[model samples]
Target: MTELDRLASDFGNAETAIALTGAGISAPSGIPTFRGDDGVWKRFDEGQFTYGRFRSDPAGFWADRLELHREMFGGEFEPNAAHDALAALARDGHLDAILTQNTDGLHRDAAFVGDDSPADGITDAADATILELHGNARRVRCTDCGNRTEAEPIFDRAADGERPPTCDCGGVYKPDVVLFGEQLPGAVIQRARSLARESDVFLAIGSSLAVEPAASLPRLAASSGATVGIVNLESTPCDGVADVVCREDVTEVLPRLRDLAASG
Candidate 1:
């Protein structure tokens, strides 16, 4: 049997299955990976993205943030086939949840969480079964008061020269995403670890598996006796340890995997 056939059989037999995705999964949807050749890193200084930097120069931080907001959310980007496949698997009970490292908000869009209206030609996954390792860029949070709200309005304010928008409590509003050098949310990390430990099959999709803490999930699942699968265009650190490795386009592979899992 083929590798995909084996994956399908294993998926069919799995009692619990989970997927971990990264920027590569969203790249097909026109979201640029931050570390790629033409990525955001080229234009923006990485040192300025830290929480410390934001604290030191709030106005400057917001100045950069406004530019980033325009770059990331200014265009109409949508989830691709890979997102739909994962959503389909979840809808069909073949997958449990998706754990993602992307801050792009494409997964939520694919899952249809925010709107009564859908994007043109995009189908909503039946449920929003996704866990974000990095926080969503589409949402904003008050650094002091902890109030969370949609990011669009805040972006508009930023565009209108409200560099750093103030919350009702007069606290600074920042994107909900975890900044560089900031600790990942404790509860989110714990839940992700718990899911990895409990999974019967762990699919690592599009991630290079280089980032710490979140990158350790695949190893955690493998150590716990789960079948580990890695799917990426390039080699990942975990490829040697993965039971199944498919170096192919995520958009193509995910749909095939979904079909096989459903058929099996």
Candidate 2:
């Protein structure tokens, strides 16, 4: 059988199948991946995104954040074929959950959660099964009050010369992303690890599998006897160990996977 056919068969038979995505999945939607020649990381100072720097200079943090917004989140970006295919898989019950490292919020925007989901008929509590390893960029949270809100208004204010927006509770509002030097949320990590352990099929897409802890999930699934598949434009360290490796653009491969899943 072809690699895609094998993946389709495994997915069709698996009790629990999950996908892990990174910035590469969103690249087709016009989002730049980190470390690319024209990536946001190259445009800004690395230290500016660290939690320590933000704590020391809140105003400066917002200033840099404004630039970041312009570079990354300012444009109109929509979910590409890759995201739509995954959503379809989830809706059809061929996929159980999506564990993503992307902060872009495209997965959520693709209507991963809603009353319109086909999975709602399968289970009463059916909701978008998403585990965001990194927090969403479209949201802002008060550091002290824990109030979360849409990030556009704050970005607008910042663009209008508001150095740093403040919350009604007098707390500083920061983008709800896991910045450098900040620990990933413990609860989210635990959930991801649990999913990895329980998954019968794991698909790692558009990620280099370079980031720590998050990268380990695929390995965990593999070790637990899950069929591990990876799809990326570039080679990853796990390619040698992955049960299936497809070095193709996610936008192209995922739709085919979705089609194969639908055929069966």
Candidate 3:
């Protein structure tokens, strides 16, 4: 049998398969990643996304971010075949949950991919649980009162003229995403750890496996004896330990897995 066929056989028997995804998974949807040549890093320095920078120039920082998010939404980026495939796998009881390192909310959006397009099974979308490691961009939080609000109008008006908006508590309203040098929320860390602890199969999709804390999670699952698989355009640090390594376009392989699950 082919490697993919063999993977399907193994996947079919897994009790709880959990996915760890990174920016690569969202690239197909037109979201730019932070690293690599011509990435956000090359265009803007790393200091741009830090809390210290935001604190010093909150208006400028937020204005830039708001513009980017507005472009992301207006770019008309939709879920690709890979996203639909993962949703399909999740629906068939193969994937227990998807733990994503992305803050773009693509997986959350991808979970509902078939709600509009009836090609993939619509029933499985509801059963999928997306565990976002980084916080989402669709929400804004008040730094003082912790009151949260939707990011639509906040971003919309900001894109037009509202430079920096404040919350009712007189605190700056920031995107709910975890910024550089900021600690991941304790609750989110706990949830990711719990999911890794319970998984029988751990899959890493499109991540370089270099970032801290979130990068440590797949290792935690591996130490606990969970089968680890990686799919990325290039090799990663933990490549030596992965059971299955496929250096191919995620959009190409993910659809096959989804189609297999849908057929079964």
Write model 3 residue lDDT over 24-53, tens digit each, in one string.
898988888878884776766667768887
Ranking by TM-score: 2, 1, 3
Question: What is candidate 2's lDDT per residue for 1-264, written digit by digit as tens?
Answer: 899999988999999999999989998999887776877778788888889988899889999988887788777899999999998888888988888888787777674453222211111225347877888777788899888787888888877887678899989888888889998877778878988899999999999899976679888999999999999988998887689999988999999998998897
Off by over 4 Å in 1: 115-128
| Consecutive 10-residue window with the lowest summed lDDT within model 2 | 115-124
Q: Model 3 — which ten-residue stretch has the worst lDDT? A: 114-123
Tens digits of per-residue lDDT for model 1, 173-207? 98888888788877678878998999999999999
In model 2, where do residues sit more than 4 Å from their true spots? Answer: 112-128
**lDDT over C-alpha atoms for residue 32 of model 1:** 73
What local lDDT score does residue 29 receive in model 3, on the 0 to 100 scale?
Answer: 85
**Higher-TM-score candidate of 1 and 3:** 1
Task: Please give the CA lDDT of all the candidate structures.
Answer: 0.83, 0.83, 0.75
TM-scores, one per candidate: 0.93, 0.94, 0.88
List pairs with backbone clashes in candidate 3. Answer: none
